[model samples]
Target: MRVLVVDDERGLTRALQRGLGAEGFAVDVVHDGDSALEAATSVDYDAIVLDIMLPRRNGYDVLAALRDREVWTPVLMLSAKDGEHDVADGLDLGADDYLTKPFSFVVLVARLRALVRRPTGARPAVLTAGDVTLDPSTREVTRAGSPVDLTARETSLLEYLMRHADRAVGKVELRDHVWDAPGEDLNVVEVYVGYLRRKLGRDAVVTVRGTGYRMGG
Candidate 1:
């Protein structure tokens, strides 16, 4: 496996190169964030070992840029600052894993192996259907670049439909999953569907005659 090591510490970088090379990994080392970003975008490494402190730009900016450009290569962020907020910031920006300074080399190798073995197709937090977008984390929805306010039930219902976009979802199935209970009134599904259609537009949710509904304009 190939790995990109982005760190300014020459001794640490050299030691990692030797250790990781011995473990049958082809390692390329870069000393700064700009170089890291350039190398990451130019070549598709199996995984990246990125350090938080670097020249020109920091690791957060580098990882953000990579994700913004749709580069999904797994990243392992390294840092001397082990604060809770620091770790959260790195993860929130898309670093797959994090290691603080004074970490074990053995542990680092194991983490890298685990990261590379993980499935790379982690879904984006946001979901979109045509011009409609839903952020489950924020419980926010927007249609055609405009905010669309929705109640909790409507949000849950729309989220379900959007998740199963292009597929006709039955009312009973919707109730079973999105509603309070499977035994709850099925008419509520129809009511919410109507609410979604009226709020989002008539064509937002398509009724499939005998079947339930599909999301998309």
Candidate 2:
């Protein structure tokens, strides 16, 4: 799934982007609320990690604006403030969850999974295409009763394809969804699709000539 991480802390943002990307998520990072607003407005993200304190606009204002604009993407607020009142305020601002500073990485990942697992939320933990099954929560993929081992990037690609299975997914869309921007100059999508084909077997993914790619139903 795609996520937007909005934090003024450059180090934290980078770390999260890298870490989450490795965890099979497409991540975009912006250091301020304005840029976060712009990106969130433009793209469809699975969730947003918004910091409570920000320049120009606080997380509360940003969350309020998103709701006002009818962008109902789930938000997980981050703050140094751990008081009950602060958490309540974030919830009041329409945040789905909150994480205090110095939180556990494992716990944070679990929370993200919970947000994604909500049927009404953006990301989904389970996805299927024909006889192939993928479980994002467990990071497992099985086809025809056989387990498929995949690299992190391959897993991200397969998830995207399965989510949009039976539909034409162009190279650009794949790049946007699976690859972090600025995308690689090479034909990375084709390369990874080839890798997945080799790993998952030839019948798994189909190439649509002049279009892009798709997972067979």
Candidate 3:
């Protein structure tokens, strides 16, 4: 299978490239988040080994962007941060798996084998509300029959809303899930919700003054 190794450590990456290459993986290496993002979006890699704290864009940003674009290739994040919340943040941001720095190459290989062996995270069938439809697998959203262009963040937000179409989803919830905000300030949610409305029509997402926002009216 193909793999992308993203880390700024040239020496380690070279070693991994040789070792993983010997293990029968077609491995490509990138040194920074910007390069990682470009490679990931263009190539259909079977798996990815991403390091956090990358220059340009960090691992979290790259992972979020990939998920937002609906590219669900399994990811194994490498980071020096071993704190519980750090790991939780990676997982919450949509990483398939994570490895702390100084991890054993053996363990890494084993984890990659397991990840490639398993089926990807199960995605729900295409979601529909009123005239809008969303296909999670393709990250495709359509209003009526025509296509709509949405940024990565916009798509992620819309997916969350559509998944819970039955009730109101509070702005805080949206921030926590979509934006990964740590503080109480949630104006970003409102801004993105407005962005979604622009693409999905003004009435796409309903705001609950006292509660939160919900899918459709």
Q: What lDDT tens digits, residue by residue, belong to model 3 across residues 1-217?
A: 5678999999999999888755545578899999999999987676799999999999999999999999988999999999999999999998889999899987898788666644364434677878888765456799987899886568767877886788888876666545422363788888988998988888888887899988774
TM-score of model 1 (CA atoms): 0.56
Indicate the residue-level lDDT of 158 in model 3.
82
Q: Each prediction's TM-score against the native?
A: 0.56, 0.90, 0.56
Clashes per prediction? Answer: 0, 0, 0
lDDT of 1 by residue, 100-140 (tens): 99999989987876666552655456779989998765667
- Model 2: residues >4 Å from true position, as ranges? 119-125
Q: Where is model 1 more than 4 Å wrong at Cα?
A: 121-217
Q: Give me the overall lDDT of model 1.
A: 0.84
Q: Report the error of model 2 at residue 65, Å.
A: 0.6
| Residue range 1-217, candidate 2, lDDT tens digits | 7789999999898889888888877889988888889989999887899998998888998999999999988899999999999999999978999999988877877787678667275445678888888887777899987999998889888988987885989888888777777466449888999999898888889989999899975
Looking at model 1, residue 28 earns an lDDT score of 84
> Between the candidate structures 2 and 3, which one is better when assessed by lDDT?
2
What TM value does model 3 have? Answer: 0.56
- Whole-model Cα lDDT per candidate? 0.84, 0.85, 0.81
Candidates 1 and 2, the one with greater lDDT: 2
Q: Which structure is stronger by lDDT: 1 or 3?
A: 1
Clashing pairs in 2: none
